[model samples]
Target: MSKKSFTLSKIATLCAVALSTSAFAEQAKDKDIERVSVYGQHHKNYITEQADSASKLGITIKETPQSISVVSRALMDDFSLDDINAVLESTPGVTVEQIETDRTYFKARGFDITNFQVDGLGIPQDGGDVHGTLDTSIYDRIEIVRGANGIMTGAGTPAATVNMVLKKPTYTTQASASASVGSWNKNRLEVDVSGALTDNHAMRAVVTKQRSDSYLDRYATDLTLGYIAYEGQLTDSTKVSVNYIRQSKDADSPLWGALPLFYDDGTATDFDVSTSTAADWSYWNNDNEHIFVELEQSLGTSWFIRARYAHMTNEQDSELFYVYGTPSAETGLGLTGYASEYDYKDQQNLYDLYATGDFSLFGQTHNLVFGVSSADMNYQDSSLYDYTTGNGFPAMPPLEDFEGNAPIPTLEDAYNGSKVEADQKSAYASARFKITEPLAILAGGRYTEWDSEGLSYGNSKVNSSEEFIPYIGAVYDFAENYTVYASYTETFAPQSEQDQTGMALDPITGESKELGIKAQLLDGQLFATFAIFDALQDGIALPDTALSTPDNTVYYAAEGINSDGYELELSGRLTDDLSASFSYSHVDIEAGDDANEGKLVRDYTPEDQVKVALNYQVPVIEGLSFGANYRWQAKTSRVQSNGTIPTVTTQGAYGLLDLVATYQVTERISATFNVNNVTDEKYLHSLYWAQGYYGAPRHYAFSINWQL
Candidate 1:
């Protein structure tokens, strides 16, 4: 059988097995099958009760002393937020910078969010950018902790940390299938099967598969996800669990970079929303595999010893086309094409051994947690470029008549780019103490060692760093349902950008401080917070024009970059039949004492933003519900040099509106209809780069789901 056929066959077999088990479960005694509650997994709730992305203490969000936001599964389903970018866009205080169709960067509080975790395990990248799509089908919810997370993530930026919690198998057998059809010839199908594979509910498995087309020109994707877990009660005091996960994504005709927004004469260029720079043969593919093992032993009722080990691997392969240089507004005759092929692989092994217990100290019962965690990661990548052209790169046709018909260059004999190898290691520990009934304190520190040596485009690079980061926070409950919190944390981020001397810049180091008040209302179902934050960063890399490289890239360290911001957010159920999430944020960023002092920092990020979403159930019509989401941002501007002249690119303030309606067709069937960008707004997707793309116009999708 073909590879595609084999993949489909595996999905079908898993679905069949789940269906059969579900049927058998229906006949089994109700007491024999453990009933798992779906309130935290699939229910229509906007807020979760607890989060530990900032601190590994597994504390409640109200006690974490940081700005925390959660994107629940129900929200993703209602809005059809199948991609990570969409999910983060819905979150407060986060900016999704879509530089290309497949490449993206996330920022918060004037800094890049480089820390990302899967179920509390770190998944650090070389840079603060994401290369491939991260589907939300297999995730239960996403937790976003804003500010420095040095206690948990070690060396990283201070913007935020994202923790994606994956869906786990239930004790009882279940299966779900969905199909969707949308605008722009978009089509999607998804299947999920999860349940216990053993009678005792010890062995469980979750399998998911999704395939979809895009609204962009010449873009399509296919995804396959699988998860298996085994949990057992070895004795009265000892428990063990093991899990494995595999996910793969294959994208066709994905854009390597976006379109240039300016012409050679310093005039802005305009294009339709469907315009794409990708050649027909361009593609990007990636695969991720993970393994996890844990053992827990109870020393007493209030203490436990746990050990965890995780191994993960990420691999990517792609052949891409990049369009560079600006075309003339009249003739459109200056563009060129570069063809390249890339292979990348990253592997990580993590280990943790921790112990937690309550101890009596100073006549007060305080909680103490002492542990150590170590993570070792290795990265390797290589590239092959087409150097067969006489003028250095293949020239493209006029923009007025250009289609994705650029020549596919032969890359076998003209390869010039080659290998790279990098490694990172870290160890960390944290603790939480309860000083009194109304006050708590959290403190922790991390030590990290990182080194990288590589060759790229005939340039040899080597860099290494060793640093220790510290964290502290305090929470005080002054009222019945209200608390005041403060936190201080530091950040460390490595850079690969080179200065004018062709030497790698020093790592960035920063400090963050936050003061906030949190409240829980409506019987602890509603969550609200208002916070003011300030951060100072040093050794920030900035483009330097005094000197230039062959590739037109040069950077210098900018010191004393300050970011000041405030945010207000509300999330949770307002009434028994109504749920809402709302947020507003304002930020000001500037260079304090550098050569660029008093200048705006990363002005591409908006100064003010708002996001609102609400869902309501109709009382008059049973099984019918409606949801609406709106997002708005203030004007943003960036200065870019076109050839030898400086120019400005600006995007005025704009808002997008989306609506969804759902109805229950049967007890086990439901239908949902969604319309996004209801106003058909025409706007640039991002301004992070000089080259940009337009956001999708009005689009609609209808989906039907069946579950058992």
Candidate 2:
């Protein structure tokens, strides 16, 4: 069937499901009351005994007026999520491009998302050119807040923010262990244990180990993670907690090159198909270690305070090979062959301290937060060449016969090196006020200072920059079960002196204005939200000169603008036999110059995207359940060698189907089977230029869990 026909058919099916309720209602009535209360509420209520963690902390999710998605621990376990990409791939408005087995780039709302947090404390989003992959075993939940978040996260783009809540010590004792095996010789083991050591002391620990022989030839990976935490009640109204986490991974191969593009006339080029350009490759590995401490104190009637401190370090060392072509002595034109080798090393460290408090003024509530942070990051790169007959090139002959003999060059003849260092400091605060029983308002702001130094090829440069951002939002409860909200927010990106001339360029900032309605249906068992938004970024800085020069690279500057169409959503069964959640987003983006000249934006985004997932438990089988997810995205642009070519787009809107079943063989033991990409669609999860990597094919995994 045609793409349009398939899309329409899928839409029809979804509409039908939304309109029909006879089967859903009937099945829901048969479930036990215990399960009903767990899934019935559309919006969480403060009076509930089992309130959500965020709600218990007095955080309002529905009234935030921002696009956010929360992935609960229950959902993670159900899906057997092993990596950050796996968990985020099913979320709306988020896309990921994996450069290698362990490295990935994330985008949201048509822009790169470079803000991340652990337990509400900010962390480096781009860990550097080296891939920064975190093990998912230690997280309790993940939250994604979209749009300009500088008010809460300091300095960053308006794209989106990701905050990971770590596992904490609990008052109750519990332990669980799981082991799994899958296609491509994949195997994994995870264990979690938590309990109270004394009346006022609690502790928890998590450990994971995984190994995989990838679907691609010569690709393999091994990973390990360990986490531990302790919590203690210092006084009747004060609590303190500390945590430590470490992760490491080893890979046999890293992606260094991409698929060849077409020739000048658009005809495709066929490079070697068998002779591998990657030779004797391996990574000494990368490691991440973190330590954090938090203190919470509650003052009588209407005041509370929270203080937190954290330290983190990342280290990496690796060797890589590149491919190039050799020229024939007769024709002068070269034949394609292997290239050179490079050795790289890097280390980064970050420190953060923050405090927040909640108090009542007159008869209303207010929240205030502030923080300071610093980073010391470093990078080093070196290169070497080969002089042997075929030292640099692959040891094996080319896939096809070649008629040329080319001498390899010496390492000392061609070499380059560089070093970079950066430091940052920031402060921020926010407040929420309940103007009336049915109306609330929120406002906040932040300021950040940054400095960077670089030394490359014996030349050094230094730069510094600073910025401030602000935001405001309000919500009005129209009825017992409905509310309306609107918000405006601004974000800024700093300019570096080394990169930006001393011209005092204004910070690139934007405003997001939105209006939306929310409903609480099914006796509070289900919550639904819909919103419309118009977001605009003004005074965007652009390159000044279009031409390149020998001595100075021509840098230009201009004010650019972008406007977006936005939507937000949330849904689930509060008291039904089956529960589910879904989200969708549509954005219309455009760019304009200071003179109002309009141009189509390219290479960084797609105009439309959708993500959906459904999970249901069988009424007859106590431990049996099923779940599936589907994602679709419209094509975007890419930069090519010949100016800008719109030919290379992502794998045009693909669907992934998954199936899972779990059975309890004993009180302490259970087994699960998961089948991913069941249809085996050959598509790309991400695309860069004309070279696209294929998504994982059909795979099957089975896991066993034991509780003690």
Model 2 per-residue lDDT tens digits across residues 617-686: 6779786667666666767545444345333333456677777777777889989888888898766545
The RMSD of every model to the true structure, in order and in angstroms, is 9.8, 12.2
The worst-scoring run of ten residues by lDDT in candidate 2 lies at: 46-55
Quantify all predictions' global Cα lDDT against the true fold.
Answer: 0.78, 0.61
**Which lDDT tens digits does candidate 1 get at residues 1-708?**
232332323543543454344322233222121112122221276666556677655467777789999898789888999889999999999999998877899989987788888878775566688878787877889999998888778778778999988776566777888888888666677676766655444555555566667767777787887777777777888988888888888888888888888887887888777788787888899898999888988654555667888998889999888889888878888888888887788888887666554555554444444455666666667677767654226787765566677777665545555355555555455666778889988887876666677766665557776678988889999998899999998988877778877788888889999999998777766778999999878887777877875666788888767888999998878887888899999989978566363254457889999999999999999999999999999998778777688778888999999999999999999999999999999999888877888898999999998888
Which stretch of 10 consecutive residues in model 1 shows the poorest summed lDDT? 33-42
TM-scores for all candidates: the values are 0.88, 0.82
**Cα lDDT for residue 208, candidate 2:** 96
